[model samples]
Target: MKRYFIILAVLLTGCTKQLTQTNPNQQTAQTFWKTATDAVDGVNSVYGSLMLDGSYMRFTHVVLNTRGDDATSNSPWDQIYNCGKFALNVDGFAASAPFTAYYQGVFRANQVIESVPPIVMDTALKNRVLGQAYFLRGLYYFHLADIYQNVPMPLTIAQSSSDYYARQVSQDTVWMQVISDFTKAATLLPVSYADVTGLDANQFGRATKGAALAYLGKTLLFTKQYAAAAAQFQAVINLGVYSLVPNYHDNFTEQDENNPESIFEVQFSRSVGGTTQGWGPGDPQSNWAKYEARAITFGPRNFAYCDVQPTKALYYEFLQEPTAANQVDPRLYATMFYNTPTMKVYGQSFQATFGVADSEVFCRKYENDGFVASEFVWQFASGINSRLMRYADVLLMYAECLNEEGNTAQAYPYIQQVRARVGLADLATVKPNLTQAQMRDQIAHERFLEFGLEGKRFDDIRRWGWLQDPTKLAWLQARDPEFKTYTTGREYMPIPLAEIEANPGVIQNKGW
Candidate 1:
C-alpha cells in the first residue's frame, strides 16, 4: 500500500484549479464530490501537493535548514542564496512557493473534509478518509503557522470568491486550530493500515493514529506546552509501533524507506514517473517530476548541483563529541562528505577539489550515492523518500519536553537511546549529574547532530530563544556570519506579495 501511495503521489501534482467561484455560471464543483472514489481522490490530491516544489518535501528546506547556521546555499540562484542569508523578499520564489504550496494543500484537504462526509460509504473507510483530510489540514496549517507566523485560517472549503479572502489570525489561534484538526484526526485514524483488516496493508504511507499524535505533540512542543506535549509523545511511545532504525544511515536511503523509524514521510518514486510530459534541459529523465530535487541540490557539484553545503561549523560539531572509540561520530560520516581520499560518494571516489567552488564538503543525508543510476540527472531524479518525522526525532522531543517539565533525570535515557544507536556514549556516562540548564543544552546539541539537513535547526534555535539572545546569536554569527543580519522581527518569513495583492486588507509580516 505504501508503494501504491508513492505511485499515486508521483502522478499527481498541485491542483492548479482555484477553489473560489467568482461566477455562478461556472460548473459546480459539487459535481465532482458525489462518490466514494471522489473522497479517496480528494485526499489523494492533498497528498499530491506534498510533492510540489514549494512543499516541505523540497524547497522549504531553504527556509527551514539553509537559513540556519549549519548550512549555506552555495548556488548562484538569488532566491536560494537569499534564503540562506535571511534576505528573502516578498516577491521571490522562496516566499511564494511555501505560501502557495501549503495553501493548495489546505484547499484540497478542505474539499475532502467538507464533501466526503456526505457520501454513503463503508463507515470505517469513510472515517478513515476523513481522518487523513483532517490530519493533512492540520499539517499544512502547522507549516503555515511555523513559516508565515500570521496566516489566515480557512477551515471550510471556499464556496465563493469572497470566502478565499480570509483575514490573518494570530499565530496562537492558528496553532489552536492545528491542534483541533490533529486531535480530531487522532480519534478517527486507525493505529495502522495493518489494523484495518480489509484495507491494503500497503496503506502504510497514509496518516495513522501515531502520526497524528506525534504531530499533535510536535505542535504542542512548538508552543512550549511541555507537560501536555510530553504526554502526547509518551502516548506515541506506548503504541509500541515505532523505534529507531538500528542503522542511522538506513533512515536516509531508499532501501529502508518507510522503515519503523519513519512515522510519516513524503512519498516519492522514479518508477511512478513524473507528472510532466517532457523532460527539459538538464532533467534526469522524462520522469523528473516523480523525484525530489534535494539529492541533486544538496549533493556535491561534481555529482549534482550542490546548491546547499554544510557549514564548516557543522563539520566541527561532529568532532565535538566522538564515540567511545574517540573517533568522529559515525553520524558525521553518514551525514556529510568531504574531500577525503578514503571517502566514496555516489559510487565515485571522493576528490579534494570539485568543479564547483567551495564544494569540497556536501550533504550526504539525501544524496543519491549512486544507489540507483540515471546518470548526471540522478541529482534531480533520486527517488529517495523525504522523511518528515522519525522515531529518533520523537525521542529527542520527548527528552526535551521531559527536561522542561523538571524531569531532568528522566530525560537522560530517552536521549541516550539516540546516542547509543550511533555508538556514542550515553549522556549519563559522559556528562553526569547535570543541572536542568546543562541537560537542556545537551539535548539541543544532540538534536543538532541527529537531525542536520533534516530541517530542524532553525526551529530549534528559535524555540530555545538562542536567536533572540545576543550571546547565542553571536555564537551563530561566528559560524555562519549570516546570523549577523538576522533581526528579531525578521524571524518569520514575509507574507508573499501575491497574497497581499489578492487580499488587499492582508497585512505583511513585521520585518517585510
Candidate 2:
C-alpha cells in the first residue's frame, strides 16, 4: 500500500525536473506548463499538500477535533491548547499553519486547472487530471471556509506577487465556489480506476465521481442545503460503489487502506524516504511526507508526545448504551486507550506503559501493531490512511437530511444500519416512532459516537447550530470547559495576523 503512494510521490516530484530549470525570475506558469507530465505533476502536487503538516494529515486535528468537546490538547503546546479553548487570536501558531498549508494546495490546484488544458495531450487523461485538481481545490476551499468563514477565493493561477493578495470573500461565495468545483469534477471524473481504460489498480486513490459527489453533498450539508445535499448523497448511494467495512476499526488501520467504506482518503506512505517534517520533534530524517504523524502526536507520553487526549465525556458516552452482549461499544476500545489490562497498544501493555489511571485515555485509532522497540521512527511514520469521508458518515448525513426534510420515519433504517454494526439495538426499537426533533437529536448522538476523534465532531456542532444555541453552548461548556469563553461572533478562526499584514486587501474574520 505504501508502495503505491511512494510511486505517486516520485511521479509528482521527479517528473518535473525540466520545468524546474526554467528562469527563476519569470512566473512559474510561463515556463512549467509545457507537457502532459507537467499537468499530471501539477495536480499531484495538490495531492501532496494533503500530506503536509498543516493539512488533513496532521494539524487538522488541532483546528477541528481538538476544538470540539471530545478531545483536548493535553500536551503543553500553547497554540493547540489555545485553539481548543477558543482563545485563538490572529498571531497564534494554530492559525498560521493550516492557513498557509491549505492555500499552498489551492495554488497548486489553480496552476493545474489553468495550465493543463492547452498542453495538447490525450484529452481524456487531461480532463481526468483537471478533475482531480478541481476536486482538490474545492476541498482546500471547503477547509478554509469551514474554519475561517470569511476567506479569499482565488480561482486562477497567480501571475505576480500582487496576485497573491486576494480579498476575503463571503462564506456564501466561497461555498458556491466549492460547489462549482466539485460539480465540475463529478462530470469529468470516472466512477473508479476500473472504469478508466488503461489505468492500473495501483492508481485507485485518485479522485473519482463518487468522491466528488460525496464531497459535494458534504459541502451542501454544511451550508444547510439539506434537500440538495440529500440528492447528492442518494446519487452516491445509487452508484453502488461504497459500503461500510464490517469492522469499524478496520477503517483506521493500515491493513485496510482504501477499504470499501472509504469514500475519500489522504494516501500516506512510510516507504517514501525523507526527513519527517511536522509539528513534533521526531527524527528529522524520518519520512514525514509519506507518513501520518497523528499517532506520535496523539499517542501516550511514553510512545509519543501526547498532544491530544480523549475526554471523560466521550468515554461515558460510549457506556451510555451497551451491546446485546452487555459489552461496551467496541468502537470505544478501538478509539481510545484506557486502563484496561487486556488492551495491547503498539505491541505493549497499555496499563504497564501508560498507566491504568482513569484520567489517562489517549487516542488509539491510528496506533498500528507494527511498531517495535528498535524502530522508533514508526511513531512518526505510521502508514495508516486518514479517511476524509466514510460511508457511515454518508448514511448519517443522509439520515439527517431526510429528517430535516420532514421525513423522520424514513430515517430510521439508516441510523439502524450504523447501530447494528456495533451490536447495539436498532434505534427504531430503542426509540420507536420518534418525532423530527427527537430523530435529529438521535442522529447527532449517533454521529458523535460514530465519528469521534476522526475530526467530525466540531463540524457537527457548528452545522447543528449548537455553537450559537445557549442550551447547547452550556452543554458543551459542561463537557469541555474550553467552551466557557467561546463567544458568538468568534465561531470562525481569526485570519492570521501575518496574512492580514501581507495581503492588505484581505479583511479579518469578525471579532478578530
Candidate 3:
C-alpha cells in the first residue's frame, strides 16, 4: 500500500535556490556578514546536507554492528554479507551524490568562516556565525576521519588550484585538526542559542559549547587521550542542562530531540508539506512500498534495513534472567523490534518469554511512531533527525574515565545512576574489586544497549581494543552460526583502491 499525503503549500524552495545561486567569491566579506538572515542561510546548508545519506549512513551500522556472525541471515542477504568479509573496496566509500552534498555545506560554512572577519556585524552575531562554521567544519572532519581516514585537511576555502594541491596527512594528523576545530568551537559557542535572546525555549537543535566539548571528549577518547577526554566529558556533565530522558522511548521521539537531554541533534520534521523527498536518494519506487523494508521512507522496516539487523546475541542480552524475568531493559524495547514468529525456530516463540514480535521486528523507537500512512511514506516525505550527542554519552564517558583513573568506587555511583534511569537495579552496589577489563565490559554492554543502531558500535569495539579478539569473534559465532571469521591485524579498514590510485599517498589499512 502506498501512503499519500496532500501538500497544502509549495515545497521549500530556498534549499535548491541557495545551492544553485550561491558563489563564495562574488560577495565582499563586509557585505556578507551584514545580516543575520545570510548567516542563517549559510548554516541552513549544513542542515540540508544531512538529509542526504553519506558514508556514515552505511558503514557505521552495517560493517560495525551487523557484520559479525552473531548477526544472522542466510546466504541470501547481499548488502551486509559483503561487508562481513571486509571485501568492500575503497570505492565503497567513494564520492556518492549523497556524500558530495555535504561538500556544499562545507563550502557554505567556509564562506562564513572566511567572510566574518571583515564584516561589520554586531559582535555577538559575528561570533555566533564563526562558532557555527567551526562546529560544521569539525563535524565534516569527523566524518572524513571515519571514512577516508587520511585525506588532506583543507581548512580555508580553496580559491584556486594552488590551494587544492596539498599533500595527504596521516590519520593522527587528521585527528589533531579535528581536535583543534572543535576546541575553537567550544570557546566561541554559547550554552545554547535563542530564537531571540532572553527566551530560553527558542533554541533550535544547533551547536553549542556543550556540543563542541562532547565531540571533543569522544574524539580524544578515540585517540587514547583518556585523561584529557575524561576532563572534557566532565565539563559537559557539569553543565547541568542535559540529563538522561527517564523514559527510554522519549529520547528517540521527534518531540524529544531538542529537549534538555539532547546536547546536539540533526533536526528533522515530518510532512512539512510538498515533495521535498527528504530521506535522500535510495529507492524512490520502493520508498513508499508496503512490504519493502529497505525503502526507508515508510514501513516499520525503515528501521529494519537489511544492512544493520540487530544481533541475536544482542537480543538475548535483553531477555531478562529468571530473577529479572519481565524486567528487560527499557532500551531493548526501544531499540529493536523482535518478530514472534521469526524467533520460533525452536518451536518456542522468543516473544513468549520476551514479549515482542507479533509479526515484524522494527528498530522503531528512534523513528516516528505517529506516522500515519499518508505522513510516513515517500509521498508524504517526513524526516527523522539523527542524534549527534546526548547527555547520557557524557555521563558514561565520565564514569569510564573515573574508573580508568582508579577511582572505581567514585565511578560506581554514576554507573548506577544510568542503570536506574533505564529500570535496572544497580549491579555494582558497592563497587566490588573490579579489573579494568571487567569495568570496560560493563561499560561496553551499556553502550551497546544505549546506542544500538545509531551507529557507534564498531567505533566502541575498536576503542575498547576488542575488535580483533579471536575469542570474542568465536563467542559471537556461538550465538549465531553465520559470524564471519576474522583474524588479527585485520582491524583497520581497507582503503578503496580507487582512492589509492587517485592519490598515491593514501595507504590501505593492513590485512585488506
Candidate 4:
C-alpha cells in the first residue's frame, strides 16, 4: 500500500561519510539496484516527492489554484499574495518550491527508469514499474514545462556530478520529451492494478494505461495538435475503464480517493495522530507531516487560512446556470461558502459563523470542515489526496479538442455527459446547434464552474491565450483585478536564482 511506501520514504536516511571513505554495511548506488524490491522502492521514491512541502502538500496547489481569474488569494504573507498576482521574483517559495519539488520527482523517476530494467524480475511487473516511472517523469516534466516554460530536459539519471548539470532547452523541446515519455508509458501500462498482486497490490495511486493516455492527450491538446489530441482522448474513452462519480464533492475529500473517476492523484495520509506543523526527519511513530496541506491553505475564511477564495466572477458564473431542480448550480454550494441565506457551513449557518454581508466569498472544495467540527483536521495534516486528473476533465478536454477541430456537433455529447451529471439543461435541446466558436465558449463556461479551484482554471486560461487576445484579456481584467498587473512573459514563473547560481547552463525567464 502507499502508506507503506510513505513510511519507507520517511525512514530512509541520507548517506554521510568521511572524505574518500565508504561504509561497507551501507547500501551504495552500485549495490542498491539488484532486486525487484529495489525497483519497487525506487519508483515509490518518485511518489513520495508528491507529499513534500513543495509539491502537492502545499506550493504546487498554491501556484496552480491562485494564479488565475477564477480564484483569489489575500494572504497577508506577500509571498502568498504576490504569487496569485503574478508578482513573483527569482526568489521565494512560490517561484522555487515547486520547481525544486517536481525536479526531485523527476530525479527519483530517472533513478527507477535507469535501475529497474536489469534486475531480473517478472517481466510484467518490471514493465509496470518502468511504465510508472516514465509516466511520473512525464508528469513532473509537464508541471515544470507549464510553470517554467523553458527548462532543462534530463532524460536519464546522472552518472557523475557533472551529469547533473543539465543545459536549458526550449519549451517545445520539453514538450516533445513529455509526449515521448507518456507514449512509452501508455504502451507498457495496464488498465488496472486492482487485479494485480505482489508489491503493486492495492496501489491505485500508481500510474496506469488510462493515465498515460489521458496525459498524452492533454499534452497534445495543450500543444494545439487538435487531431492527434482527439485521437488520444478517444483512445482513452474507448478503454471504458473510467467514468464520472455521482457526488462531485467526493472528488476533493479524503472520503473517496482513487475512485473510479480519478485518473491520477497524489497520495497523502496522516498515519500518526498529532499535528503541529509536523516537519522534520519524519517520525513514523509520531506526527510526520505525511498529509497534504492544500486544504488548509485553501480553506476559506475562519475555517482555515482564508488565504484563497472564489473570485466574484467565478461565483457569478455558478449562478448563471440553474439545475433541473431550479436551484443555482449545486456544484457552487459544494465549491464555496458564500452569503447565501440558510446555507450552513461546517454545521453552522453562514451568517451565524462569519457575521459578514454579501460581499465576501470563501472556498469549500478541499476543506475537512464537512466532516470535522473544527478546522483542526485541516491545520497541517489534511490527508486529502489531491486529484490531479479525472475522467470529468478528460471528457471536457475531449470536447474542447473536438470543437477545435470544427466538429462542434460531435462535442455536444461529451459536454452533455458532464452537464447531465450536474442536472444542467442539455445543450442540444436548450441551445441547439452551436457554431464551432459558440461551442468553444460554452465549453469554457462549463469548465470554469466545474473546476474552479480544483487547479484547472489557470491552465484553461493560458491554453486559450486570453493574455494575448485583446478582447479576452480585457474580460479577464474585468473579472480579476490581478490581471491588471499581469504583463508579457510574467505568465511563466521566473527561474529561481538558486537554480541559475547552481547550474550555469540554465538562464532566467524573461520579465522577472
The pairs that clash in candidate 4 are none
After superposition, candidate 1 runs with Cα above 4 Å error: 1-28, 197-201, 274-288, 352-359, 372-375
| Per-candidate local distance difference test | 0.80, 0.80, 0.59, 0.82
Q: Write the per-residue lDDT of candidate 1 for residues 219-292, one digit (tens) a residue.
A: 99999999999999999999999998888999898888989999999888777865552222111244446677
**What is the alpha-carbon RMSD of candidate 4 to the true structure?**
4.3
Question: Which prediction has the highest lDDT against the true structure?
Answer: 4
Task: Give Cα distance to truth, residue 180, candidate 2, Å.
Answer: 0.5
Give the backbone clash total of model 2.
2
Residue 108 in candidate 1 has what lDDT? Answer: 75
Off by over 4 Å in 2: 1-28, 160-162, 198-202, 273-288, 354-357, 373-379
Write down the TM-score of every candidate: 0.90, 0.90, 0.78, 0.93
- Kindly state the number of residue pairs that clash in model 3: 6
**Angstrom error at residue 470, model 3:** 3.1
User: Higher-lDDT candidate among 1 and 4?
Assistant: 4
How far residue 42's Cα lies from its native spot in candidate 4, in Å, is 0.7
Cα error, candidate 2, residue 7 (Å): 32
lDDT of candidate 2 over 1-512, digit per residue (tens): 01111012112443333654656786455678887777776787778778777776678866888888889876687877788887876776678777777877887788788788889888888889999999999999999999988888888754454564567789999999999999999999888887565332248679889999999999999988999999999999999988888898998888888988998999877766565454422112344457777777887667677788888888889999999789999999988888787887667787777667745777888766444541255656777788898999899999999999999999999888899899998777779999999888889889888998988898888888998888989999998888898877677888877777756677787777
lDDT of 4 by residue, 1-512 (tens): 01111112212332345356678998877899998899998887787777767678888888888888888888988878988798987777677777777777887788888888889998888999999999999999999999899998777755555565688999999999999999999999888997877789766689999999999999999999999999999998999888999988899888899998999998777763455553321223244556777777777666788777889998898888798789788788888888967787788888877776756888888788668765655467788888899999899999999999888899999999999988998889999989988888999999998898987888888988888999998999888999888899888898877778767788888888
